[model samples]
Target: MKSDVIADWAARPGRHIVNLSGGKDSTALAIFLHDKIPQIEYVFCDTHKELPETYDYLDRLEAFLQRPIIRLNAQRGFDHWLNMYGGMLPSAQVRWCTRKLKIEPFEAFVGDDTVWSYIGIRADEGRSGYISTKPNVHPVYPFKELGMTIADIERILETSGLGLPAYYSWRQRSGCFFCFFQRTGEWVGLKEHHPDLFEEAKKYETERGGEHFYWRQRESLAELEQPERIAQIKREHALRLEQERKKRPNRPLIELLGAVLDAEDDERGCDICHL
Candidate 1:
């Protein structure tokens, strides 16, 4: 079925696209197919709420690819969507943010055309791409089909001169700075690196006359930003990193950090947002 889908898409004269997430995997996939698929359209569904590093990484990737990456954006943006949703912040269980900010714009871009969506999910990952369910949109996993792993992705980025986004040094995944999927350590990283954004995220959390909303399910950002809480999170993250390093002494720092973060929060984030 995979081979048939690949062949069918190759034979069709429809849209060929790769959605970038400003993360390593998607950037590597874009670089991997830069020469192989000249007609491939690279796109980023800009939430307009992503970290500055994410935008910088996307800019670098565009230069490396020597092509424009179309930025798909929601007509109203996050603030508008939040209002429409009754100021209820999106959570893992109620991920209306992904649907409004990412998927809707992507689907609108593809319209009714038969699109072959190239995904960057690696063979080592046990998750599938989150793409449009529309019958016209066909999802394809190039990295998985090609048997590429995390190491292969790193090699691709390195060879292409587009290494991982700077955020990887601290946070493992990529999405909005205030993404609810962020672990406690990542939230601390945000507070330390981008305090202004952290403040903005905190502003989002409010009682609003008896309705309590928080980015994290258990605690509010205000509470998480406390000095003692930040220190505790850092200590826990350090312990995890130490344990992971002891387990895999030869692993790359980036891989080790990712493993630690995954161990911290096993939930695989929104595939479209974090790929």
Candidate 2:
């Protein structure tokens, strides 16, 4: 649907909301739908542990939107949840983080209002993100209905003067600084780009009892930081990129990025946080 058409939907009396995840797709969607949905409420479920780049991107988006993107949080934040979980750290198998940090806050924001949530799942993507089961919160997919693909999303962000998230240079999705869904190479990038955040992530893995947990099941940040391991991960990533280029020479760099991440680790990222 065109912007004018969607504008009509936003012009209605009921609450219209868009959740920004600080990721490329969601950011693009916010930019694309901003002028069209003049009254639409924009929100971000802040985990309070996101990368600095994420916060920066949100600020840029907020300026572009010309309004506050409401920040939601559980009464306490990530540290509170981590302490409650005995500092084990959240993984795909037990994603208490998403439920507490993202979903609950979003639900609380909507409250009893009948909200129309606009999601940014592209037409090319096969999987669905978080769609609230709340009877009052209706989810709508403008990208899907309009058949907008990855190329279209890039165009939207490019034209709107809000390129891509800074993290896109290494990481694909946006979430917490130490999201378990990150690839090994991206983890390396994290260390190189933001060593302090990397160290903070490492600190979360160790506890008072001397017990240690890791974001990746097979590796720890200390081990991953080894020069040899970092070199190996870089080599593997380079080889994978070369192989991907051979397989799909005509695809854009974005598509190649998705493929590379899938090849390294296919864990589906947090929908509520990454959109």
Candidate 3:
């Protein structure tokens, strides 16, 4: 991650873009690079299924940067694709949602252009963000290149006055409210914080031709919302937090919450969609 490499990308004589997910990492990346790359373009692929807080966070980021964030929307939209695929909801295994709603719109926007796509993955993160297959689209990692971690990201947001999204108080990842990657506790959080949206997510659970489809594996939102089930999830989450606190005391609650969620399931959420 040489400084000259980054400078070379900056002077590539093409589009320089940062894709925002309305989450902390990508938001922090945008703020960090606001002054560095004057020609940088910020874009967000709107699936029309994101949480209300994510949309609000983007508006604030736009105002802070003093630049317009180009929002790309798919022509056919989510519902059309869902119906075309026989109502099978997108899962980690079959991420048609990411393809149709997120990646496709982004690739279309940078058609045949030698674009430098700035990704927000931290150095601590083991996975890479979504890299387009298009030869013209080159991926760049500023935070990773600088060896920044979660603490560094938090400091950037705090200094910029754009702290974590409001939903981070409950849900950690920022994507569709009904993202299939959601853990039991996040599902409970969605129900508690945004009940109407929670209800909307529940409507998608269906038994199509005797094949049950739910956001959470082996559990439907209706089942997860049961008072007893929610209590159990809260109890388990509390125990995890208690254990994590013993290892690292005086850490931020948001950081603690994110660690606890990751311990529940090691499967990293979508890099691009949940950045």
Candidate 4:
């Protein structure tokens, strides 16, 4: 869609919505389009299992927008869906969590209305996030329309004084703390930064029928948490960082780390959760 398309959609008053993920890109988009669209409805689909930093960042964003970011939640949260899955935690291959917990609630909230759902996907990115299959709900990418890229998004957040979620210090994407998409280094960061939350995530992985159900397939959180395993993950991450740095000597180490980690992502997870 072009910038004029979004502007035209904003000119009408049916329903103008922006779904906030408490992630950098989404939050930056919210601020970028704040005054551009009239009566824009901001929303967040809470999974009830997000990191504390995510919640805090959302609250701060609400204050910045001076408008309520409607928080949508599944009628029944993670526990209910987990029970329906027969005690099996959601994995990338069989990701029932994003559908039931995030997308379903957001779609239901829109109902059958003609909704112009403004997404934060940038012009430089080439991937689609969650789009409702409902005929009435139309997906619009204002960031892409405006030719905004990651550098543009960073400027948007920087100018708004909401640079990035504090979680960026350790983790990259904002989603469920126990999201299986997380890398080994991110898990280690979680264990070091938030030990209690790490333990809670570990509790989610359980043994059933002599087979362990883990967020990440083939490896339980218990095994991942061992001192030796954590050290090995860190060592591998450091080597990867060094390799990336050698390739792009001028790039900042932080940006290099993000790129290297992103390269390792198998791209099997839902954009709804990660976006």
Question: In lDDT terms, which candidate is top?
Answer: 3
TM-scores for all predictions: 0.94, 0.94, 0.95, 0.94
Candidate number of the best TM-score:
3
Q: State the weakest 10-residue window (summed lDDT) of model 2.
A: 204-213
Q: What is the overall TM-score of model 1 with all chains considered together? A: 0.94
| Higher-lDDT candidate of 1 and 3 | 3
Taking the tens digit of each residue's C-alpha lDDT, what string does model 1 give over 177-238? 99999977788888889999999999999887776889887889888878888888889889
Candidate 3 local Cα displacement, residue 273, angstroms = 0.5
Pick out the ten consecutive residues of candidate 1 with the lowest summed lDDT: 1-10
lDDT to native, each model: 0.87, 0.86, 0.88, 0.83
Question: Could you tell me how far off, in angstroms, the CA of residue 41 lies in candidate 4 after the best superposition?
Answer: 0.5
Q: What is the lDDT of residue 232 in candidate 3?
A: 88
Q: Which stretches of candidate 3 lie over 4 Å from their true place?
A: 1-6
Candidate 2: pairs in clash: none
Candidate 4 Cα lDDT to native: 0.83
List RMSD in Å for every model shown.
2.3, 1.9, 1.6, 1.9
Model 2 ranges off by over 4 Å = 1-8, 207-212
TM-score of 3: 0.95
Q: Identify the runs in model 1 with alpha carbons over 4 angstroms from their true place.
A: 1-11
